[model samples]
Target: MQKLQTLFAPSAIAVVGATDREGAVGGAIFQNLQKNFEGKVYPVNPNRDVIFDKECYQDLASAPEVELVVIVVPAKVALQVLEEAGKVNIDNVIVISAGFSEQNDSGEMLEQQLIGIADEYDINLIGPNSLGVISTHSGMNASFGPALPQTGTISFMSQSGAFVTATIDWAIQRNIGFKDIVSLGNKAVVDETDLIKEWGDDPETDVVIGYLEGIDDGREFIDAARDVVMDTPVVLIKSGQTEAGARAAASHTGTMAGSEQAYEAGLRQAGVLRADSAEQLFDYARALAGLPSLDQNTVAVVTNAGGPGVMATDVIGESKLSLATFTEETIDAFDDCLPAGANIYNPVDIIGDAPVDRFVEAIKIALSDRNVGAVLVLGAPTAVLSYADLAEEMGALAESHDKPIMGCLMGGKEADAATKILDKHGIPNYFDPARAITGLEGLARLNTIRSREYHSFEPFDDVNSDRVEQILSDAVADGRSRLGVESMGILEAYGIPTPEGEIATSPSEAKEIAEQYENSVVMKIVSPDIVHKSDMGGVDVGVKQRDVEDAYERIVTNARRYQPDATILGVQVQQQVDLSETTELIIGTKYDSQFGQLVLAGLGGIFVEIFEDTAVRVGPVTDREAATMLSELRAYPLLRGARGRPAADEQSIIEIIQRLSQLVEDFPAIMELDINPVVARPNDAVAIDLRLTIDEGKL
Candidate 1:
């Protein structure tokens, strides 16, 4: 990652279309840079003598030692300027020119030509239609935008120049500082992932942020963002999540936006901090940057009102954070400094009338407790003592005790004073307890994920590559890319377990197998054409000895009626195991345009689409990560025995997912796999239905 600052900064900069004409983009850009930038400026205009107190040059050849050039000229002339800039070894160019790529094919061709020229000289480019890039640390302002704030630690990268300028203005108003901001219009060459990777390692940048229209390479974005996440915190405000947004994103950045479900799964797998809105992106970035890595998700709340404490509890619970129950020792310490009627449990009610010392003692007790990883102090202003003094003492205790502390003050003017005092001490404080708790939840969730990752799983090597190749090859020969139950069953025997079933060519064989297995069994008409057995009524469950004879006929008749064009391959008879728990899980591969085969895992069944509960780990997820993913599901409580029923063997599900992940990782030809209704019987689980898709082109 060459230093990103160079792309926007130069000792001597050239503005190719700089003019004296009022309200022109070129004129605005020249004025903005002249106002804020401290670097040498050269305004390039064929007709003008001078602009912004700098001598105007006729072309790139006339600008002496131009290190970075901003092009606001027409698209046709922009290409020529890039070509000339390349010849002169001007290695950094910011194209504010709009007629490339965002307009039509003609513009796209022009943008490509500019890229080719830059590539010939190994020069870096920012955009063909951009507000340009800015670096506050270097005093470089190439964007034709308002002045940006210089306080917080954030970096914003976007595919739209308009959003970049709007975000800069918003940040400036809120006193939010930026390290680096880039507008990657069209993304013809430079992409979101490229900048994320570069910004993550940039010394001036603390928290990397983005406003993404769409990812050009979904897989590359995942890989690069995952690598960056290992070091810097990344928050993305992904805009193209809906159907309408997807179409707009494709037109805006020339990217085929993926399904919303898949995009979210990928984000979770990469462990990137996700935000639904730009405000959240900024808030989360601000809060997370100052917070320490929490040891646990348990938080203690000390509030002057019960209402606020209840609200905080609700938020914490909703976010999967726990409210700590103070130990007997902790309660005794709090009682010593409080009135007799004060509540001393997890959410301690210090009462509204409590003075500064009382609030301080309660906070001290909460922070000192062994079980508490963090404390939320909710103080209302009191006339008897100074709120600022109380806030100072709380901050002092937080610093000395080595525990994260946050506050929510209730009174209007006094609360602001107290909150500012906490901020001055570098404590992460919010005006509302619920918001503070939400931030705490962020800390808690991250800690849980980190804890789960500590125990890694070993890789398994039980896959039969030769069998996979043969099955995939045969499927492709017949214009079919998906494998039937029989083929999937064969693959399953090699560590991927399927139901105890046997394929039979004749009714006699089906009956014999049914009798051999149990009094109760299932008879399913098998055919490569019918992937979903239940959809075709090809499955007959609870087959007794007498019913086996009839159930076989019923399945065969149903198969022929449902799929008239297909041949009845046979029936599969298997024992019907009592499934105490009914849950579905899917493990499959999608041929991503950029990333090749990517594995996916999620809750299955018809409700799977409704619940949309899923998580991804790149192919070959460790067993530990699989288990954590399963546990992380929103509906995990149901699998953990929500009622009186015994819990499913959670470890078994993780093992299956891990094995399938390894299979997909080893065999690129296996395009998709579905394990619906993996019946869990307290101690064991079995894949009752299976289907596979293969891609011969990949093989």
Candidate 2:
């Protein structure tokens, strides 16, 4: 990796296409550099004699002793300027030209040409279409935009130039200072992962935040984030987590947005807090920056009203976080500050009429409690209390306390005062209690994920690669990706407990297989073209051995009638496993063009997509991670013996997930695989049905 310092450092720099005219990108670039930069700046323009009181050169070849070159010329001219700059050993270049790789075919061709030239000279190019870069610590403002206010511990990276400037303005409003800001337009040479890796290690940057439309190398980005996020938190506002969002992002930055599931999985594995919006990006980053390490997720809410506290609890229900269950000892301690009938539970509501001292005492007691991981103080002005004084006291107590303190200020004018006071003290606060809970919960969540060290799964070198390859080749040769039931069975043999079954190529074979099984069985039409068997009425269930002779004939008849166009592949006959008391689980893997293979888990059957009740983790999920993923799901309660039912063996489920994760991580050509209705009984789990799809050249 080329040192990031070389990219930002330049004793003498040249700005190509610098002009005398006002409001031009080149002119703004030159002027901003002149205003903020402590080093010498030279402007390059054939027509202009001088720019911003600095002598202008006609080209980079004529510029005196320049190290870094900023190219803000037209697309055609920028290419020529870079070539000239390269000749002069100017290895660091920032191309602010827009037409390359962002407009049309010609632009893409031009971008490739520029990259080839830079590669030949071993030069580092920031972007062919970018707003350039900014560094507050270096006092360098080479970007063509309004100067950013330098104040907090964050480094911002954006794919959009407009968004870069907008984020800078937003940061100013929130009193957040940036250590460095880079706009990666087109990503002609450098990319976001490179920035994440660099910024994550920078001492000046305590937290790294990105406004990303798409990643250049999804796996690399994730690994880089995972490597450094434990030390310096990373928050990303990824723009493409939905089909509509993907389309919008693709159009916005010209980067292909891959599967939303894959993106979500990658972010979670990397421990990146994926924010939904730009505001949440900074909001979450600000909160994470100041948080101290904590041992638990027990939060103490000090709200003036009960409604906000209840809402906070509901929101917190998503994570492992819980409101602190106040012990009788702690309850007795809090009695000194509360009125007779005030609710003294976890919320610790001081009622609407409590004074500043009452709120302070409540907070002190909560903080002193060993069980409480964090404290959330909610302020709603009443006739009795001064919110400013309460906020100040809360801030003071937080400075001395071991745990993090967040504020949720309600009401009108009182909320404004609370925000100002907290903002001044560099304390994280929000208008909604849910946001506060989310912030506090992050502290505990971070600690939990960090405590569990992730060990990468060993490669499956012993698996039957030859057999798997032969099946994959056959599927691809037929111009089909979906595997037949027999092929799916072959795939599942590589994993855990597959059902005892046999494929019947003919009605006679079906009868023989049916005779072998004593109990009722399931028979499904197996066709490579049939992606959804039940949807096409190709499945026949509950055929007893006593009725096999007639049932086999009816199964064949229905299979052909339902899909007359589809080839009459064989029927698969298997014993009908009892599902009355077992938990239905689905494990699936899909290849994403951006993020690579992603492993997904959820409650199974038809309602999976409808309920959208699922969780994803990147490929090769460790056994512990798989357990955590299951435990994190909203439906996990059902799996864990809900309503007096016997709880499923969670370790068995975790083992199955580990195998599935390894399969996906090893076989990149497998575009998709699904094991649906994995029946988890009290002691074990079994896969009832399976599907696998392998795409050619996908590996």
Candidate 3:
């Protein structure tokens, strides 16, 4: 962060390949830098000695000592200019040149050379192909983008240069300001994590927002962002989401989980708020940067129009935010101040003909309520009301009150003057009442992010790591990347209870194992090539002790029929669990390519994929996180004893989730695992069936 502060806050800047030529990238960058850069700006171009009437040096060597160098030459020449910048003892450089890693093979080779040079020089490089960086506080406009953003608390970074330019244009019109901006294109050196950490320590930045296509190191990003988000709210609009395509995934967990789900969980675990669109990105940012943190999740709507007020009410009710139920004293106060024909309720509508003073009085009353955490001022344009004056009064109320406020002065251009006025008092004005509710929602979300109590991995003394390691080694030696019920030893080693089971090579052995179980036994054909035993009629549930031999013989015959060449590893004679009062649940882990291992918990059984009611989180989950994961499921009600049913042993299931996470994290060889139909009874949870896949290469 200290390095970044120095790199970004340079006293002198050199724009290499600066030219007077029309339609050139260097000329655009040089001209933009001259417009805002307060420090000495040297233009380095060997072909020309003059650029935009400023004297240009022939090369970086000829130029005076500079703190930062902006490279805007071709991909080939950009490498040479980088070497020159390094040789000149410049510690920070921004390469705005294209065709590096984002281009072909030769371009990638050039980028590698550039990385080597930066490493040797210990330089802080911004980009090999980027729009560049901007520091408004330092009055530095190092990017090619034209718009110079207003000076404010929000700092932003984006993967796309075009996004930064467009957002700047939007911010200027919307009056949203940024402290620092960076276009992190082909981030070879400085990435989003660096900027997040830098902004976290910077007092100037109030909120950190970014337009991310992908993260460089997903795990590292999570850890870094989690540390900073509590102090400075981090908002992001992640564009691309990935899925496991054409990969041979052996478990139900791997098939259902994707990089998109990983991002969803990873970002949440990191205490970062994800935005679905660009509108949401700044909508969250503006609110976080300007408004006070919401003390509660409830909101009170004070409006002149009935319809818009209801719209605000609807959004508040639907979102995590609730409609504030004003206290009796506050309601009586509203009745005293508001005129007749007004709906003196939570959405305290003073009628459409009401003026700014009536609206002000209503808002004052709403904010006075202890129940109200925030207020939404939605006023439609009326001849009787003055948006400008109303905005001034609201701003005054905002200054006096501790509760946050957002407005919906719903009109084009008519509300512009009021928007700025409200903005001055840390109150954001929105055109849409629904959008106004979201602004308040952002404040509420920040409170949650700040107040979150993060939990670390819990230490379990009962688990046996050596036993699990031995099981994995056996699989590797056998050249088997996947296992069925035969792999239940892994669960037992981790102290996760499974139905008493033993593999039988012959019908007599199967019968003997079945006789041990008092009620009945389940015969499942064990084969490396066969996954879904029931589909091939290789599974027989509730087999009597006398029928165990016939059941075992029939299961093996079905397995051979399904796949003739499959190695029949024999049958697993397991105790049959009574599913009468138990809930069929699934607990599994999918090794995501980007965010590492992800643990999932939800409705189990065969329909797990169809229902898709699951919650995922990064591996090494703690007790609290495991419980939180289960609570996220829509079927959470069932586990909690919904619909006149005995509640399942949810705590026991949570233990299984944590133990599985520990096992998976302990051994990277275990790629994907599924403990389906984890029979959850009133007092105990047991693994009924499991299918685990391994990465032979990892083993």
Highest lDDT, which number?
Answer: 3
TM-score of each model, paired residue for residue? 0.83, 0.87, 0.96
Model 1 over residues 148-254: C-alpha lDDT tens digits?
A: 55745577888877788788888665456787888888776677887888887876667788887777877678767766766677877777676654432111001
Q: Which of 1 and 3 is ahead in TM-score?
A: 3
For residues 254-350, what per-residue lDDT tens digits would candidate 2 score against the true structure? Answer: 1221366677778877888788877667767777777666678888888778788788878777766887887778899878668987878888878
Choose the strongest candidate by TM-score. 3
Relative to the true structure, how large is the alpha-carbon lDDT of every model?
Answer: 0.73, 0.77, 0.87
lDDT of 3 by residue, 1-699 (tens): 137886667899999988888988888888888887788899998888678888889988999999999998888898888888878888889999899889899888888998888888888898888999988888888988986888888989999999999999988988888899999989898898889999999999999999998888888899999999878989998887754365766777887777778889988988898998899887888888888889999888888888888888778888989988888898889889878888888788889999888888888888888898998888899999999999999888878888888888999777998888888887788888777777788888778878878878976889899988888888879887778889898899999999899999999999888878799988888886776777899889889988999988899888888899998889999988888977898899988777888999889986887898999999889999999888888998888889899999988999999999988888877788889879999999999888888887776
In the order shown, the candidates' Cα RMSDs to the true structure are: 5.1, 4.6, 1.9
What does the lDDT come to for candidate 3? 0.87
Q: Which 10-residue window in model 1 sums to the lowest lDDT? A: 248-257
From the highest TM-score down, the ranking of the candidates is 3, 2, 1
Cα lDDT over the full model 2: 0.77
